[model samples]
Target chain A: MPEQTDRTENPEHTLVEVRGFRMAYGATTVIDRLDFEVVRGETFGLLGSNGSGKTTTLRALLGLIVPTAGELTIGGEPYRPGRVRVGYLPEERGLYKREPVLEVMTYFGRLKGMTAGDADRWSRSWLERMGLADKARLALGKLSGGQQQKVQLGVTIMDDPELLILDEPTKGFDPVNQRLLMDIIAEQQRRGTTLVLVSHDMAQVERLADRVLLLKDGVARAYGSVADVRGEFGGKSLNEVFLEVYGTVGLEEDAA
Target chain B: MSAFGIVLRFEVARALRKKAFWIGALALPVIIGVIGLVQFLGAQSAQQAAEEQAKAGFEFVYLDASGVVDARLATELGGAPAADADSAIAQVRSGETEAFFDFPADPSTQPVTIAGRHVGVIDDGRYGAVATTLLAESAKTEIGSPELVAIVAGGVRTDVTTYLPDGSVSTAAQSLPVGILLLALLFLTVVLLGQQVLIVTTEEKENRVAEILLTTTRPNAVIAAKLVALAIAGVVQMLVVFVPVAIGWALFGGGLSIAGLDLSQVVFDPQQILLGVLILLGAAALFIVTLAAVGASAPSAKEAGGFSALSIILPLAPLYAAAIIVTQPSLPIVRVLTYFPFTAGTTSLLRNAFGTLPLVEGLLVAAILFVSAALVLRIAVRAFRRGALEYDRMLGWRDLLGRPAR
Candidate 1:
């Protein structure tokens, strides 16, 4: 396993640290001896294609999946749930479909240790900020796909989590809301919230990420700042760099 | 508040807000209340109809001429002796008395003469039954000694006691309905409570809510809170369904006595009641947790719905074997059903209620089920934890069997 380097420029310091992390299900190792760090107040992009163990890594980092062998710390301590103010939006977007939009948001907010009144107040403010205040009382199922995505994002960010992990948060949004959501996430990042953004959208990652780690087949394909990765792939954009990285693997596997 | 409390309160409030929950929770009690109302109304209507019929029909006027028989016979028949037979006949003619039972001239073996207006109201069969009752009294007074009358009128009172092969005796005076009640209460718990566990857990899977919840709270906490919530819901629904029925039963069925039988005489073994309660709790734990696991494994609520029916049916199948259980208590099939964790509650309850299961055997079965229930709950927690992020897919059989899925 490679060692993780610590950068000295950050004030909030390291929020997530993984050293020699290994994860497996029975015989299949989904993540194999990977190392990474998510510094405080920075957007860390975990970039990978489908089935590349991105979700598995985030799950391990959050303590949802136990590491087969390694040390992982969140907020400078062993990863104990509810010990830190953390929020997550899973890739498969879902809320209580029978619940109204605001209710669903507040329920999750309360689960993250917010009191009902505080949760309710924050949830409604978020709904208003996201241009969904009128639909607060409507059932989540009644909302359009894009609207539900917005509500899901609201749930993820409403509690002002110190660290927030969003998996495919912009999945069903339109171009306008997509940019709107990106701006909102950037604003949250400016407020000193450490964010781990896991997605296949290279353009979004390149625009938002301060540092990035690219994984292929659960092994790091590239690990550096965006400019370093762009320079490694001959000054191409992160999207072109991603294509260059995986495009060779497809051919090699085909030839084999 | 603690995360468990938050989760529990959230789950319960969400479930109660649904229209289906309210409908399902209220259906049984409403049905029972309607039935109780009908029963009470039917009884009152029948009594009133009988009184109206009696007002229009023939009522006997005793016309005794034998001085020795005059007072006692009339008192026994709920009437008084007439001053004059001629006056009674006159009264009958004027509709004051519908009929007359004229006494014999002497208190010999001769039959009394009955006179009445020839109408449909003067049916001989009705008057004859009255006459036979009165004559039997007269004969007893004339010939029967006090002890003979006691022996003839009130025969031997026997209380049944069954001596088992083990030489321990059982009292058979308790109503069999108590066991049936235990059976009902057990199923109602499963239906009202266990099924909600299924729906709630399945909704978590179907909606992908577990994906977020697992990160915020521990899996075991999620499972624990879910079970607690469903338990509260089950108790609430059971009370809603049963409280009214119980009130109605107490109000109307207090007089629901069998002839020559006393409710106070019925006694049951405390060990057997405890066994029934143990069986109920064990079955509840097993069924609710197992159903939650099944629901968690299902990919969608629609799929879970089918398994939900199976959940209900599996616990219910033993109830259909009741006829076999009654006469062939502890028959192999019944015994198997009684000892198995899922089927044990209602089966052992029925058996215990019937005094069919011996105390030792019942205790052993309850202990096994209680242990099994505890184990299943632990297994369910493991399942919920492992299956948390498996959205849009099922727990593969290989994975469920503790083998590598890939």
Candidate 2:
């Protein structure tokens, strides 16, 4: 794990802030009073077992759903398109599968506030960079799973959004392509983009995230810098720490 | 472009690119054209056969025992005097002459008899028509005064004008075509465009793209843009079918007039047409928004398919109740159909064309649709937010009623 400095001392550095967020569906509460923050220019890894409210939290943060009780804001205000440029790659992982890759990419680019010409240009460039230039005009469903994921990521980051929220961004990639995706994410980090990555892959999270938050059943189990989290959990790797948090059930679920 | 504009442009482009849309769009017109061509050719063949039959005169003979027969008129009408009824019948049976007509002495008390060669059942009626014309012409000649003959030859002709309670004067004939035209327009615009609206709205949920879309733009704008795009696409499809039909009518319509309708006597009312346009606009908005709501609430496009069919069937329900709409517009059933959002457009169009809809009632019906559309638009937006991430189960009353986490 790379050593990242702790920036919790400064309020101004916070890019994302969630306070007392509670979400309940009918009689059951999925998340209860959850709280966390991500500083600007740092990669924040949001880790959790399956059905542990990682997606729910991100959904609230991006204003995809209305929170039942608390505030989930980006850049100190509620997320709204054109208020801040945001790129979101959801965990469900889909696109307009019947549309051409370039067309789909360009459509999302324009929605993110790019001009048509600029959106087309950016889409083509991203397609080439992802080694999918030849598949640009093919229907998205015709491509392999990993190739489609690449195009989806390209759509998310094409307009250089200030905040990028990627839920399992490398879910379908092979190891080689996964490494390539990490490089691309690293470039975004260098551009000062704040990233909140949700993934089950502990090593990938440990390598990329400056700070990490481990959620279990919607409660924050561990938070702060990567090194601090590891040190607090017996100085073990994040993979070992994740096992401690979720127990053997997590292993069974992940295996399934 | 604004977000709404971008989404609208993209959606329209997507629909236009689908091969199914093009195929569906062109299919109806082609089928109609083929049917019309066949009918036209059939009519032409029948007319040619009739002209040939007329040229080959029916050399029939008549024995007028009443002494009122006009031989000159009978000859001109393709009949000649027969020496006796028995000989004429013999000739007809032997295929020497086409028919024989025997007029009774007391024509009023006893019926005139005719014997004709066997043709088809329908074609045999032409013999009766020819005999009747010959007898009427002979009677007119017996009257001897041209003025009296003119009055006797044709019965009194009367044209009726009705004064409606609303102080408008109209003939029943004037309203029929307008009513038919409006009904046809409603079917073309709503049922056809409705499928497009449902598909566009539900595909995002089926493909799991709604969440990403919600994050990229306001959910309300996304829904609104899709509604607008669908409306525009429907207009395009309507034009694809209507333009050629209208052009064909303009070119060939004079020769192929509706049999009972006299075009010169048909009066087109401007107010009725204008009200019809308003009803159309209101109906389009209401149906599109409602379909959007159905799409958002459904778990998948496949599930939404049932609701799509329901939406289409409901609007056209008024068609099945056409007897009540046309004859009893003041009935409770008509009132219910007129005020309900789904059935309002078709009911209003029917009433407006029939002149049974007052201006106030027409406006009220249109207002109901517009108001319902606005309310449904809000529901659709909220349903989108609630159902955006749900892939397996449909959003029911509980999910829609309960707000989602912010």
Candidate 3:
């Protein structure tokens, strides 16, 4: 089935296409006329400040939330809830506190359509890779938060998802775990997975992203390769460029 | 190996690791045993104490207005003869005598009457037997038939025997404890299992786990796995409590006695048991699905609690209607509850246990519950997927009617 579908399509090219997308909650618009494309095997970054709708646009691409008005497609097909080949790591960190690590990972793998034995085998290898082989029998809550995050990441990639959407993947991790996460992301890209990384960290975004879209006030302020966007800001850092595009005065100014 | 099996395994493992699950599962049965032991010991001691108190000779008086010539009457009334009627009456009036027997002159007109201030204060089984004999004799005299007199007199000498054709008397005793235990076991299981659905949904909403899960898997699969998992955990807990108690009763001679109980008439046959179990599964499924859906609809766990409480409390209505259901299982209220997904599980189980359900009706009830469970599950999954992915958004009736989520 994979070969037949692959032969019939341009698998070496664009994997996700979002054209003239607009999303709104009532009168408050989050993404307006957004246009972008994610080529196969690239680690793309959706760079934005808080409430800049980075999460919103990524969600749209995965068909998690429908765009108020837009066209989004995945794998040369219209995005549907079950048909879309995407794995997502949401902004909030979540794990069933009582579930053993191996069991939790395998359960997620099976849900993504793998057989139980396959899921189990993949989970075992993933755990070994993350240095969690010995802790496979331990409940998720018994592990350290960083260890749990590794398990969550394993659940996402275990299915060999065609597209991966990770929101703030390194939000609560220390530098070491962050490095581990980056490695996993790099590995996924090498395996031809299209990644949409939503992050506020400028250094990580700059270092890893093939292309960057700076979203501000529900509009794309900058959309191009990371180098091109950075060059447009006259050698400014991604963080400085983000602040310039989306005014950072409201929250802190109100507090002061 | 199958999708369902994998989902089931994950759920069971997750629930088993929760500390609250173990505590709730084992506590009630132990408490029940301890309470039963205490009550039994207390009853035995009370009986022994009463026997000791009976050693003191009990005073008696006779109000024989008929002036009968038989001297054996007074002796039969008490172990020792009374000194005089006047003195005996004084003792009776002052409450010294345990009882006073009054035989009117025209015994043919009035039956014998026994008056006592503290008749039931002690176990006076002996005195009760004597009174009954005297009343029968008086009744015989009123009949005035020589042949019947011989039969009545013969009946007095005969030992009375009681038999239960349905063997329900013994079955009732056994069923009482088993039924209570089953009810409690199921109740606790529902609460524990149902809480998992609520907690998982709430945590997902709070921590945004649903968003991640929704991306790769269908919402229906997630919701289905959750309900199945909780149900399996519930069944396991029930078995843990049920198997031990059932085994102990059977092997230890304290098991449910079917000796005198006519179990043939019991309504809950094997088919009914199956139907009831199916209904229970459906009810449980519906309850959890509704709760998860509502929880998903809510903005936070605290808000979810309010909605989940509605699902939790709805099943209890059937319990309150238990007495009525047993008497009239086909009553409109019972019929409706039996058909409704939420109440059908428990009510139908009880009805089957009591042997009240008819065959055709039971199937209909099961079908209704099953279909309802499926429908609710579908809606719940949709709600969960929509709620998780849509950030800070509320689902309304309009949204459900609108275009399906892509």
Which number leads on TM-score?
A: 2
Q: Write the per-residue lDDT of candidate 2 for residues A161-226, one digit (tens) a residue.
A: 888998988777788778778887999999999999999889989999998988887788888889
In lDDT terms, which candidate is top? 2
Tens digit per residue, CA lDDT, model 2, B262-289 = 5545566777777788788888788778
Worst 10 residues of 2 chain B by lDDT: B48-57
On residues A1-256, what C-alpha lDDT tens digit does candidate 1 reach at each position?
2224665356248888877888887799888878888888889999999999898888777777777878778876766667898878888768889888888888888888888999999988888887889999999999987888788877777778899898877887798778878787878988989999999999989989988898887888888788887877789998988888899889999999
**lDDT of each candidate versus the true structure:** 0.76, 0.82, 0.71
The CAPRI quality class of candidate 2 comes to: medium
**DockQ of predicted model 1:** 0.33
lDDT of 1 by residue, B269-319 (tens): 566667777777777777887788777777765666776777678788876
Compared with the true structure, the alpha-carbon lDDT of candidate 1 equals: 0.76
Question: Interface RMSD, candidate 3?
Answer: 2.6
Q: Rank order by TM-score, top first?
A: 2, 1, 3
